[model samples]
Target: MHPTIAAAEGLVIDWTQMPTYNTIMSVAAGAGLLTVVWLARALQLGKPARLEGYAVAFGVLGTILTLTGAHMTLTWPLAKYFPFDNIIFGEPSLGFGVLLLGSAVLLWRRRELPETEDRARELAAVIAPLNIIIVGLGLALGAIAFAGLIFQLFAAPPEEPISGAFAQWPWVEATFMSGMFGVTGIGAVLFPLALRGYRAGAPRTAWQWIVGICIGLPGLGFFLFGALNFFTHVGLIINTMGS
Candidate 1:
């Protein structure tokens, strides 16, 4: 049996915890759903379907706010680097991710770039930053979740394995990894391809592919990862008692 703390007229029990894994999972799931929504619209005959053109403009702005918060978590309390957690810094990458999406939208709307096969190779340069965001986020989230899982397992007595599709451990790597894996990577890859198609004079179908793959996917992924990170970690946070 795990140990419990004593409290006035009550038992202060500490529950097992796992948050990193959960966050990543949310990120991934959100990305997945968005992907599906965009795909369905791509097949339409008219102008490509969109989540909301102007609304998506907030993509860049929202990313900036989010990155700011994430950076704070890493630097101050989270201490995710030297003298603290050694996982990785993903804030910059997410910034780049938004930049990629924003830029692509701008390019598509304006139709400034000339359409040519040769341009495809050159255009890749524009998309490189986006890919970096995807990789950086994926790796960082995965590593952090893994680290959290180890911490949680060691924090308490180990439980025997139970039969089930999923284990109920407070920390699990998949949760966070799922989050990181969401919009950024696959979307990063697909966006450019679709954007490249658009630049190459491809139809709305091509552009929709990019939007579906990128923007649509994030909501679900973030929600899932956020839930995992929040619920699992809350119990382990060492809450203070009011006298």
Candidate 2:
């Protein structure tokens, strides 16, 4: 039996064959593509309404879709391989929920403001102070994730089993994922507004660029990595269908 087919059906005893895993992956990839477009549009300036719309949609609806797709991917694994494990099921679920809630707040705030550069600057004022703390926390989390990954690479025994590796390091994966979201989804997306605020002589302080750079670097890295992954998934899907 193909590993993909077996893993796809592992949770369902009654189903002889299931394409659930592939379907979920496909959905996730679709949502991810939307997110990429949303992010791109949000990054552009000149039109305030379009900018706000893209930001709100990307932060709120886009993240929601991504979370749903992630949950679908997690379902079979949780039900089959790690039924007794709480962290495996809990971390990503809870982390994504937090991300969604944060996005909701951003959406609500953006909706309340009028579509104008002044209005955008005012919103950036509101975000500038909060960004410092959030980006600082994101950086700390990123450092910890890097440390963990280094340890995993250098310290793990040569004889350690390769199978179920992700299941074995649930916290590491969860923490890294959380950091990635914080840096890319929250910090990177919001920092542009901070830059705008600085340009407009708004509430942003001079030193804020340091925070932006810290968060932006990781955000770019995550974006590139995700792009690579997305293309890889696309190639896999194409090959699968061709066969």
Candidate 3:
């Protein structure tokens, strides 16, 4: 009854009874998948000098992850701060994923030239201001979250469980705390720089740097967290399910 592939496919556990480590890693995997997909699409679009295409798609991916993660009990700071729900149903997350994916697909379909400079200019002008606003907001909020995480590292424990697994494995707490900063920090900082490079299109120096910082480092963080979680807690998850 271990949580092997078959077990995961067929296992049945009440939502409320699921452990915190399982929820954290599961949500991380989903979010990471979205990031990878968006990164691939961005690279393809950027090759054709379609910076706006990539920007819009990347924005959609990030927007969905941030807003949806803030709502999901597994990933949200609110879930830890409040007490109403632990693991909300996955339907809403799935719906948002589909909406963002569909948006990306539509953008991909229209990646070719519009045959009119006026049209392209109009779209770029509109998106430029929006990009600045979105990236600015992301940076501000990420800084706030990073600060909160730091405070938690040193503060007294709450009577309620901020992270249940932290009691058993302190690394679990670090995983969530550092992972949040890594994900959000990378996105907020690197994205604006990437967009600027995308727009410049001259020395062609920005694209690789953008991809490296934005995708590579965050990806490494996710992979590290996943490895650590598996090594430290996968057996526990399997055993809990079997029991």
Candidate 4:
């Protein structure tokens, strides 16, 4: 067993409320993904008219993620079973949430722009200077993803009861979660390049495609996983009650 779970062996938890965390984080991830998709489409079509809507959506999602992530990071609420989860899930969410919120403000301020193409250029220009920070975040995420993958493969292996129905297919659960991290890492690493390409009027560029796929896939996965957990958690509650 993982050390954290081992440490938390005797503690009783209310599984019913656990899904709330999953739901909130997943919604934030999904909304952010949708925002990115919309922004990409707008940029591709050179339409800035709808940028304000995207900005509003991003701001809301970002706020939700930021608050939740901050609380998780500071409190380490899951320390009992998965302490590292605080770092793996919380830190990235916080960082990315702040980025989204900031970007929303920037986009909102420039909503009067006539062309999405120009907006992209301006955004790219603003972010270009932060390449170092972006790269650092990418590296951190990559390291976290790699570590999480290793832990999932060799440590507890997700066979614990917390895995619920997935307890039988530990490797699948491991791969799915780790894969989400890996893709999100890749997206962060390639984000600057993708933005630069988009700004240069190359919406169809490879970097852009790769980044979009990486980010969008994880977004969908988080959303689906969270949604699935809601039902699974209810089943768990029923089973516990029946027993």
Question: Where is model 3 more than 4 Å wrong at Cα?
Answer: 1-15, 19-106, 114-133, 140-148, 151-180, 197-201, 204-212, 223-234, 239-243
Each model's lDDT: 0.41, 0.41, 0.43, 0.67
Q: In candidate 2, what residue range of length 10 has the lowest lDDT sum?
A: 154-163
Pairs clashing within candidate 4: none
| Residue-level lDDT tens digits of model 4 in 125-222 | 77676667667777887887677667664132232335544555556566777777778778878888877656534447888788889888888888
TM-score of 4: 0.81
Better of 2 and 4 by lDDT: 4
| 1 or 4, greater by TM-score | 4
Residue range 1-243, candidate 3, lDDT tens digits: 011122454433332433333245334434554454444444434433463565475456545544544455444433333222222223223333444454455446556645333333333343454455446544653554454455443121221123333444444454455454456445645544544433322343465365445555655554465455554444444433444
Provide C-alpha RMSD values for all models, in order.
8.4, 9.0, 9.3, 4.2
For residue 39, give model 4's deviation from the true position in Å: 0.3
Descending-lDDT candidate ranking: 4, 3, 1, 2
TM-scores, each model vs. reference:
0.43, 0.43, 0.46, 0.81
Clashes of each: 24, 0, 0, 0
Name the better of 1 and 3 by lDDT.
Answer: 3
Error of 1 at 152 (Å): 4.7
Q: 127 in model 1: Cα distance from truth in Å?
A: 3.5
